[model samples]
Target: MVRAEILAVAVVAMFAGPGGAQSMDKATDCGYQAEVVAAVQQARKDRVGERQVQQHVAEKATWPENYNNAIPLIAGWLYGSDVSMRDIRNEDFAAAWKELCLQQ
Candidate 1:
């Protein structure tokens, strides 16, 4: 998945308008972004269906409610054919996501 897709939800919330300033702290937002990714990744590993991933995340997420909005997008990317869930079973996507988020 593209970086934009991974960051979309958090980015949208961080910014105000076309050229408006950021409304939230980047570090905290990125951390929440990583949480969303981690939650979705775990749900997928648990065999949660794409259609059910949203609900699964909503029920279990410990992050801010706003961050949960990213669940659908993250789930779609994780469940997409291009990404093999089995192949990523051992990967720490949450850490990778946080690293990328902070770098941006």
Candidate 2:
């Protein structure tokens, strides 16, 4: 429940701009965003600490290098205090995030 609220806020913030309508037209961008979410989920499942998530992801990054810039931001949310590692490991957060992103 808490994770859902956080995800909502994050998605809303991402689209909070005058050009948000234009951005929504490019749903392809969310594909990479989803990939980032998946990677972070894997990191959590692998027992990687939030402090090491950035480096850990960079080391085994499969997503495009351009998307590397978003690792820190996504990592913060996945590893934030409000979210538990258990939630990440047990839930399909990457899929949920992608669905929400596409719905925009």
Top candidate on TM-score is 1
How close is every model to the real structure, measured as TM-score?
0.77, 0.70
Clashing pairs in 1: none
Candidate 2 lDDT by residue in tens digits, 10-96: 654554455443344445666666777889889888888878888888888775565566677777787778777678768887778
Candidate 1 vs. true structure, TM-score: 0.77
lDDT for position 59 in model 2: 84
Candidate 2 RMSD to the correct structure: 3.8
Q: How many backbone clashes does candidate 1 have?
A: 0
Task: Give the runs in model 1 whose Cα sits over 4 Å from its true position.
Answer: 1-23
The TM-score obtained by model 2 is 0.70
lDDT of 1 at 20: 27
> Per-residue lDDT tens digits of candidate 1, residues 9-85?
45544533443235667777778788888888888888988999999888987877766667877776778787786
